[model samples]
Target chain A: MPPTGLEAVFLANRDKLVRFLTARGAGDAAEDLVQDLWLKVAGRMDGPIANPLAYLYRAADMLMIDRYRSRRQAELREQDWAEGQGPEAPPGTERAVAARQTAEQVAATLAGLGERTATVFRRVRVDGIAQRQVAAELGVSISTIESDLRMAAHALAALKERIG
Target chain B: MSQDRNSPMHGVDTVAIDWALRMADPARADWDAFTDWLEADPGHAERYDRAAMTLLDAEQALAAHPDVPVPIEPEPVRRRPLRWIGGAVAAALVGAIGVTAWQDRPQPYAIETAAGQTRRIPLSDGSVVTLAGLSRIELDHAEPRRAMLSRGEALFQVRHDARHPFAVQAGAVALVDLGTVFDVRLGQQTRVAVAEGAVMVDPKGAALRLDAGQAVTVEGDRLIRSTVQPDEVGGWREGRLAFDGAPLGMVAEDVSRFLAQPVTVAAAIATRPFRGTIDLEAVRHDPAVLGPLMDVKVRRVASGWTLEPRE
Candidate 1:
């Protein structure tokens, strides 16, 4: 079987692509995004492109834009929920009940985080402190703070999934 | 949403966390990678949303209680002011506006500052908070005189209120003011220095009383006591960062907070200690400009800027 155009592009620019993403602030997730891009190209390769390299970069760029937009909108919605002004479902509605229950579970999970981890996460998420600033305040490396936040986030995500 | 219950993308909690942190402090390079992750799989966006929502939910729940739990502090005494303030605020809003407007009232607000940006916030209670750059503070009016310092530094002038004592919670430590002017810096450790009057610092289970010219810093469960000068309180308010024999790396960190761009030090010069003041009034924000003042070489790096030993 012949290799697809995207496969060739990925083979050529995978390292460059990951480096590009990392420089942009993807942190450690750049590898995952690039791998996913490769998979996407491999799966959807109908034929060779006129400019495979340009196409891959463009595709990646578009993906990032879409993610940014959706994430911003989601943040606004989350803010609304936090302020208790989310779309009013009837008090007894399943969605409302579920949201309340999920919030409780998330709070419990957060309360259960390790002392240092919880403090770091609270400062960033609740106190709205910057991650770099938190690291400096704690006299730890920025990566350490990021990892602590990641630990809290993963715990909350697990709780969210479990509650669902 | 359809396909695999067992797929790896279905469980993207770590990736979501990474995205969250990056989004909070994104560089020019992060957005492209973020978009790639979002576009890479159907489950990725969903997981991110879930994680973000969960975090938001937890914050809201935690904020509802005026007395937030600290890692080492004993259980908080249930304060009656919470109930009283809830009713009072609700009543005041309904009386001033209508019930509908009061129902839609905003949460007790939070103010955040970018690096190099400072804000002086006057609370409803007349207490003043001078928030330094790269800092965050939340004012829950129901919690009234209390504020939470998440990161960075703040100089607080608490209006003397015996009925409702002013308190500031920074990470795992709590600072209760005894009618004083004080500065609290929330960094790797929490430092509380009283410029006038006194302060009671509760770190873990022990409470230490700090009087004027006294300061204490909490690292994990350990409390270190030290002396502070009155001039050192809110020194950043005058556009100056005074370091007393602080390491070069720590000095660089303070400078980074003052400038729009960050400056990283070479490992060799990171720990060299210096006791002096960096006058922000006279210097440009460039590390290269600062190198001469500090006896170092500042060079532009691909990442941003790096400081090295001067030849």
Candidate 2:
């Protein structure tokens, strides 16, 4: 379908990208990457592309993989930075390391949540935007937007339950 | 209704409950059309009131248990969308009252898994989740356990996390161990199969640590564990479920994914387990080839099909 809106694009890719990402490495990573993807898709120069859903999701997946690599590189850089910082700074470095790991894990998990819902949820929750304007810009009714939130909430809740 | 809005949506009307849950959630545009519809006259509001009471009761039960991670509606998401209404709804409600008056929510995770329908869920966590046929899991996670597999079997290859430890709760079985990959099922029976690392299979207060190359079947509180190769139990990860020496009923449960709803097997044949591998790609197009092999028959029932073992 033509990508008139970001919602259609995000939904089409959400399932496929989840499966695709899980298989790659970031299985249940985080909502950040997905959010990032949505933002990128929405901000893309391509106003309306062919197979918008598939193309956007593919880009998100690629971004996820890149994110993974960046994380790895950051970890290595940190390790190298620590080694160069002398043996005197041990305990302080350890705490920093732990905090970094937690943040990374959280980021990965957020990224895994994908575009549409992730963006909507984050913008509303993280940015605290009202839902009406969210719907207006996305060009959907309030009810449809509610459905997305409901679906995301149920899915996320289930995910938390299965693992926690 | 306010006092008991947390009750589980068991046997409750799906539509009203679903919408109510949506209303409670923070992500959506705050001005719910469904809520307006329900509140338009008063009859709709009453029905919503009834469902809301049950949902509230369920949430209360979940909230009582702190360790359990209840689904937290992202208020951060909710705060502004009401603003985005261009300040219409809020500007309207300002002179009126509290937030509780707003909800009209989604049915409490209205999941319907038939006896043989294997529904796969790719979670927000990036974890691949599969709900086995005839499984009915209560998506009531406002409690300690992330999910309560109320009446069926489910396999979870949990995304590893100590902070948000993945947990699968069955009646007498609670698998909340920290590990890489694991499969959990709770229905007519409770079982936990670990493909890697180790999973703590806790039945009531009893704890059993099942390591890689090990599987366990928990019937009631009894944890029956055995040493088995990880490969044997890891087939589900590949989208192919292999059943070796499983009874006909058991086999039918796994194979029913090929059908719409689960087709039941006779009580006599329920004890007759079959051994085979179900490949989605190979058999997805035609379940006919695989169904008859186990002396089972496939017949369309309503919009879906039912599997019947030849009489």
Candidate 3:
């Protein structure tokens, strides 16, 4: 079917909003969400949308609610799988620093490290992912991921030495 | 640093905490890159300050409990806002996801704001941003963890992203985010200020930083910083507006805020200078009359307008 004026409006906004919705845990549902909103906008043509962009944003937000419900279950599972007994440490102190076991305190110090180091640490400790998976996700060699993880560990240890 | 790793969409807090843990265990290649990152900026020291404090606390908590303390939600200061956000969240999820795509390209985060209200937002990549009033921040959540401070002010409690150093736009300044808790305010110019951490307030074309115990007010193209008391900067978080030797024109404008009517200033009083802080709303209701200064004259321009510099 040749696209209609209203359909054009729907088409125009669909791709753009999909990315917007993705941030709110709807990364996978951009398509379905866009379709649902198109129907409503067309149905409610009581008057032309004065500011189409604003209307489109308003509509996109509405679609996210349904998408969130469907996505929530998946998200909870994914999160649990990723986190472990990592840095739930007591705040950094000489004693706590000496006892350094929890991942949170270690993570805080890692704030000074580079992005890749932090990512490697997060994946290995918090997510319980293997070095290979971390490497693959970052598009780096598995050895590279392994190396980064080691360096982060050293930074944490060095931090421990300074304070502990 | 341009590491824009794919990251989580929601509940970034947990994701961030988790990542902090893994980074502590068996060192990885990413760690060496982090060392390079530390060498890249000077304020990296500030970034570690709070996290260091937290680390200290985590030690205490663990020593005492040997288990993760169940985080208690703070008592609600205002139920109305949360209820509104809850309603808005529901409505957006129902329809906003798609509409956003239709209007704007995919962004990391979609934000909505209320008049005279501010928010501290947590982005998908585990970075925290404090949003100012009437501002909208968009996040890409993709490689490089891109974000735009559409308008208003924001405080970025950025998660340490080595590959993708977070960035914020404060007018002419392209606030290149290092790991830190820094504030970006939208006004005559983008204001960059830091609290617990340091930030490189790179103005793209200029150089300035709004570091801890200091504030950088940028207007037009120039950025200037003045060292002030810590809480004096962004005091609104504590429900007060703090100012130090602020100009008369800006002070009066702030005083006349939130009224159904716009506050006016006459040419004579526009250039006068004043210094002090009072309740913004209270002053607007009953303005504290600015007594005359030798350098400038203050005159009543209209029923509510004040004119400075009677020249």
Question: Highest lDDT among the candidates is held by which one?
Answer: 1
Sort the candidates on TM-score, descending order: 1, 3, 2
Greater DockQ among 2 and 3 belongs to 2
Off by over 4 Å in 1: A1-164, B1-106
- The C-alpha TM-scores of every prediction are 0.42, 0.37, 0.38
Best by TM-score: 1
lDDT of 2 by residue, B1-311 (tens): 12233323322233454555555543421332543454444344444444444334233333333233212321111111111211342233322322332343323463667643568766656555677656676553122225556666566666665555556656655566564567665545556676555576552244455555446665443455433334557465365776645667666555564445454565756877676677754555665666666777766565454556686
lDDT (10s digit) by residue, model 1, range B1-311: 12323343333344565565556543312545565666666566555555555566666655554254444432222222222223443343235434444455455778999988889998877889999888999886544566878778889988866555676777666666766789988764467777655676762235566655556756554666654444566787888777655668777776666667677889999888776677765544445667776788889877567889988
Ten consecutive residues with minimal summed lDDT in candidate 2 chain B? B74-83
Considering DockQ, where higher is better, how would the candidates rank from best to worst? 1, 2, 3
Note each model's CA RMSD in angstroms.
21.2, 22.6, 25.3
- Which residue runs of candidate 2 sit more than 4 Å off their true CA positions? A1-164, B1-128, B132-145, B227-229, B232-239, B280-286, B295-311
DockQ of each: 0.11, 0.04, 0.02
- Model with the higher lDDT, candidate 1 or 3: 1
**Cα distance off (Å), candidate 3, residue B275:** 2.1
Task: Report the lDDT of model 2 for residue B10.
Answer: 25
